[model samples]
Target chain A: MEQRLGLEASIAIAEVVCRCDVDIVAAYPITPQTHVVEHLSELVADGELDAAFVPVESEHSAMSVCCGTAAVGARTFTSTAAQGLALMHEILFIASALRLPIVMAVANRSLSGPISIWNDHSDVMTERDVGWVQIFAENAQEAADLTIWSFRLAEDRRVSLPVMVNFDGFILTHTIEPMLMPDKEMVQAFLPPWEPLLKLDVDEPISMGPVGIPDIYTETKQVQQHLLTQAYGPIVETLNEFAQHFKRTYKPIETYRSDDAEVLLCTMGALSETAMEVVDRRRKQGQKVGLVRIRLWRPFPFEDLYRAVGNVPVLGVMDRAISFGGPVGPVASEIKAAFYHREQRPKIVEFIAGLGGRDVPLSDFGRMFDSLYTTGETGKIPAPTIIGLRE
Target chain B: MATQSAKPKWTELAVGTAITVPGSARQNRTGDWRSSRPIWNHEECIRCGVCVIFCPEGCIHFDQDQPGYPSADLEYCKGCGICAHECPTACITTQEEEE
Candidate 1:
């Protein structure tokens, strides 16, 4: 049975993690990500969840503990935001290289220089090559659902890789929304007990993450690269299976009314909801506009993206983070590279918006669509624009 | 001398490059790397077992036939000269290998 409850996204994600029956929850508390581990600790302390709750000193130690537990065949989880995510950068690569199935929730927040603790993709964008399967959630419901799906995806034998679930800080983390909370029995049916492909055991000793000398270093990296690339199939299969069991469909690239659209606006995370609303207004005004939201950040979902934007003359890509003097925003840069060789591709208009927790109002999205319309007519790509910039 | 002849292909490597075998260090004979070899003058040697204790490889032991006299097992010794350097009775000396 499913129970509908109004819950904070962070708390809902924690509840989903508890239902997954994770063996270990090792984490350090950071803002926006604090509520998740805090609730999880209460669950463990109250005997509602039987798991080891390691209160690590720092985010680096948290990820280190996750790696240790996951290596010993324990289902492990952790959560962090912004600077905390940045601190775990070193271990992030090691966890995936060693093929530890550790699931993490990153409440997306802006990185510091001027020191802002607001929602943005800067933290995750900097970790693009860390080799973990990254996914973004639009709202509370998707955040909870993806947290559950992340465990299944990570523990899949065919795709034994770590997963990071990203949801906007404060926007999703602090907001309370109605979500269908699946009971323990349903979660058990969807995700079976984690059966590790390899583990650290004294009885049958095996060395994991052995020193790859020059003779074998390249070969080991080649294997890891191939495994991550091939993991796309398993990810899609897992999502399809989840849809069948839960009766809720999710795609790597989700489209809204884009079939006859002349200009499609693309975005990720909670901003997509606002973009969708803007698209509706434009459609009402007889403008052929649509929305494309990226759910999967890694493995790039090249095929799904091409199919979603098929023949759409203009694509307004809204990025939450800048690439620091690069030709376009990080998300837009990837999109441009993906379409570089293709003969039929959209004229992508890059946009950097909602930086350092700045609000991206409906008017801003309206402006993006207008620019897309102009680009569609002129067929000329303009310089990247920063939405809502004061000066 | 036990070095593997053919390395496994990338496809054939174990997941995460985990080594499934235990105590594989014994299979690698490091003696071939020796640039010099240790020789013992058993006549002046005390059976204090100091050389046996100081040999970095733990390759020095009392000669089976000559009882208390310590000798280096050339099979695994890298001729580090640790035993010669640590010999209290000055009974051990290192000589450069001909080859």
Candidate 2:
């Protein structure tokens, strides 16, 4: 029987990875993400997880080792955040382009300029175009559940793309919460062993990363893009599969009371949980309000987003990441493109908030809704408001 | 105009006849590692021992004579070709096999 246990998101993530029985874990310790890898290292040390743990020198080498191990038909994993992830950006693109199903945990943190150890979406925003399936977790429970789903979605022969599960640093990463831990046998039934299509073998003598001539270079990229674009159906299928075993169902975009609502609040990552209470409080006050939680950001679930907020007069997008000199936040920008051709579209307002670990209180979200409802009537996209900034 | 000519620099183009590699160089295999099959032009000889000293893996050795020239031990060489690049007379050629 399964039991509910209060666990830090970092440790919970490690538990599911251990249950998946990964063949290789190449990792380097870094802030916020450190506890996850540390627990994994302990698991390897104690013989609970029988895998090759390569204690690498840097995040670059860590991902490089992951690329090498995954190329040879081994299930590989790693974790990092902030500068550690920025260091691995070059290798991150290669991991997906080569179609290696390497699963990684990103303890979301602020990118350094003023040098913050706090949580933010800057690191993930910089890597938004890197061809990996990115998911944001709303709590410790989601973090644990998403890790199991990540492997299933990634290793599906149809997908074969890397997956990144982002949990907010300090807020969810260090916070303990009660989560249902599924049994190993259940997870075994959920995620099967990875069987690679093309791997380096002595008998076959196949090549990886070969220098193709100009004649075939475009075709290679076209095939990679086609395979990833076709992955949407399988991604949804696997998520529904996981939800069938577990109680909670996660989608690309989750709707909370979105039906017949006038205004919809959009958010990603752990902050969505905080936004939910704000939606709940105002709903009791007779405000036709709802929330749209974006769990997957890279594929940018266009159809689901359009359907969730259908015919709402005002749609407010809450961004933890900034695109500087752009109107829409990362999520909002993608949503706007989905409605470009539609004759009737909701007035989409963008709110850049909670950067560098600012606390987004209930009052801040209240102010955002009021501002959008008033200014949104004129139909011109209002200047985005930054909530909880250090002005 | 001469600097921007269509002709490539001599250093950029390989001059010697091509050699062939038999197996993968990227993996740490268990068996005897493949080596570069080196050819020596006896006429272009000064007997400088640069190739033997420059080998990082130390798979190169001297001939059995008073004037000892360099030869590679194929059983141990991983085909990195440090010996071919360091040859003073430019007599040795190396080739990496296509996949």
Candidate 3:
């Protein structure tokens, strides 16, 4: 059951979710995300996978159907991109607040109005506060691995939060890569069938989607917040277990060449691999530059990121999407906010780049370092600059 | 045995909380919290049935030619505020429970 030949990450994800024995998958056809559902549909047609594959009309309906199926104690999954995710924006909050352990694959893409069918962080950046556990993938291997990892994290009794594994749309989805596909039995053992503590049951005859009075509404939200924050410890433990079994190490935040470096470049997703290359090349030139790769975006990973970047003289925060009115990029803004109230902090510089699938050449890392160094010395905010934009 | 002492401790706990529990009150109406007080503006009514059709919870009802909307089941409204937001002419309002 191993295919070394070329296969898209989206299709690989489809195969893994099918083999994982997902009870239901409700997805709408959208660019980048369509291949995932299309492959799953073929699995259903050929009788390879025994699951309810609902081809919903819109992403909103897709997510709504997933919520319904997952709430009934079914292990459910779905995929969407860009405006499709924008349409599911309202129910996204409900899925998380209700604490359904539904997992989603978000083929990250730019938001529309200019309507670009390319890669960007705009789609996920807008839903940052939707209360889902967000994890970014650097490659097809991480993308597939995170999908399995997401299930374990989401279904942990303490968390019970939906997870969105965000991978750049065209960068990872369409790119052909040789991925190490784990054995089906191993994945099955790693992620057992989801048995919810509370779900719709015919024999039990319990009411779900109940009305929340204000007296109890605040307490429910408090419980959700507490679970999301407290679940981080268990999530780290589960990740360690996955690492031991599969020999794949995943951290909420990781540092490359930061041990003895003076300046650090912060990035996420597929771009971090490119930045790591730059860090290596710069290191050879006797420059004290390191790279901080943020794997988890939501639940903010504040403490992990803070400790990872610790006392570095200069820190460069790079983002793939614009925050519009915000002073810095959305990710950059959050990172800065983490250090703002602290007594000790790194000299932070924010840069927005790689919008609309623009090529982020490795040479841009040098410019980012220069900006960071200047900002640290001058005690002035660096102008939000784009590294790889066409004039 | 430990089991014998645990039984008396359970009774003591029940007795301690009994003093705070209302002795005379037979039952409390928790349903009052969900009951909606729908207010209709007679002047702004177009009688379009927009609120009725848009109510996903199906808590609003009105005659086709009525001057104002009527409540089909106020007890089940859950106060989602969809009817209030969906009123085309802004004629209807759903109220919150007063503490």
Candidate 4:
């Protein structure tokens, strides 16, 4: 009834999008993400998928083209990684602000200064406030699932917001894995043809992206924020609907072995799965350590995260990106802020790991759990540990 | 006059409430910024419709009820006078707005 293939995650994700029957795709390729657009172009050329593959000169034009195509009520898709996603920064906010419902796959990569192209969360972390619903994938199958579901969640009339699906560069994007490929009829039954809420039809004209004057600017922004916050309900609903049709379960937060565990390690992107392995190994050694894999990064899933870490005294938040001299890393800082008004908040320890595409071994995760337990026992948060640093 | 317009609360406004109506910007009274206004003369005008083509704001249209006549919607025409300049018959002229 289904096809299982040893396909690279990028190709697999692109195949899922092709099945979604997108109307237009415009993308500029960057390392570890190029295979996705390359395959999509092949599909379009071969007439396997009836869609327009616009060849843009740069990532800015890529996103701008997506905006133009989406404004016309066309189902649009694009993929980029690292610097390319950064280059689309100006239009990224505009895409969400205009509510274009464009879906993108960002192969998570480290940023420059030293000019390295590799896996990390620095790119997406730098864009945390870009107003798009962001989600991370921990493995090849998850990458395939989320890329398909991004279109569903984004185009939902209730949400009508752009979505960014982040999968780790090389770690997940380049790996070949056996993915459960949903057939065409199955996808069609799962996702209906997108009915646009608003469009650029000449017969029924409407203005879009007109200047927001001082009188209405604040209210416009308030409504946009409200929509993003309200979108969480529909996001969960669509995921449930997706599971019913495809039979693969997904949650905002995926927890592993946190039941009655004293200390919890939390992570995002591909390293989350590795952290779970370490948690199991540490548990065998008589340590009460477990993990919380944060799948939903934006619309921050505060309630689900808090529930997953329920009654755990301490949390080691592993952030692949740094905030540069801030008291804690980005994910760690957000966790603390989420706990600020809670009745019983766990003591959060910032663990900055895997910057600039450096290897983050299971040993580092184990060490982080050890430090978290010690700090909780001593009742003192350690001065933000930079794990696996040469220092 | 500005205060007469209704301000929508964020909760009341639906998601994606963009200003989408074509030509709706004319309602904002941008014509109030006019330094000059164009006067149209019917006598020397050839009905070539050249002025309609050159209008910068695209606010010019011919009224079918008034034949040989191009008219401007005074509410939106910024009075830039490109229509007057492009008039072959020199039937239109720009006059300064009175304070």
Q: Which of candidates 3 and 4 is the stronger one according to lDDT?
A: 4
The interface RMSD for candidate 2 is 14.4
- Clashes by residue pair, model 1: none
lDDT of each: 0.90, 0.81, 0.80, 0.87
Candidate topping lDDT: 1
Question: Residue B2 lDDT in model 2?
Answer: 13
Model 1 agreement with the true structure over A1-391: per-residue lDDT tens digits: 7899999999999999999999999999999899999999999999999999999999999999999999999999999999999999999999998899999999999999889889999999999998899999999989989889989999999989999999999999999999999999998899999999999998998877767766777877887788888889999999999999898888999999999998999999999998889889888999989998999998789999999999998998999998886765999989999999999988999999999999999999999999998998887888999998879
lDDT of 1 by residue, B1-99 (tens): 111334767877777778777776676666987889888887888788888888888888886536667777877889889888888988889999889
Residue A67 lDDT in candidate 2: 86
Error of 1 at B8 (Å): 0.7
- Name the best candidate (by TM-score): 1
- Return the top candidate by DockQ: 1
Q: What share of the true interface contacts does each candidate keep?
A: 0.67, 0.00, 0.00, 0.57
User: Which residue pairs in candidate 4 collide?
Assistant: A206-B20, A206-B21, A207-B19, A207-B20, A207-B21
| Tens-digit per-residue lDDT, A241-330, candidate 2 | 888888679898898888977788888888888778888998899987888888888677778887888888888888888887775487
Give me the runs in candidate 3 sitting further than 4 Å from their true place.
Answer: A1-5, A389-391, B1-99
Ranking by DockQ: 1, 4, 3, 2
TM-score of each: 0.92, 0.80, 0.80, 0.87
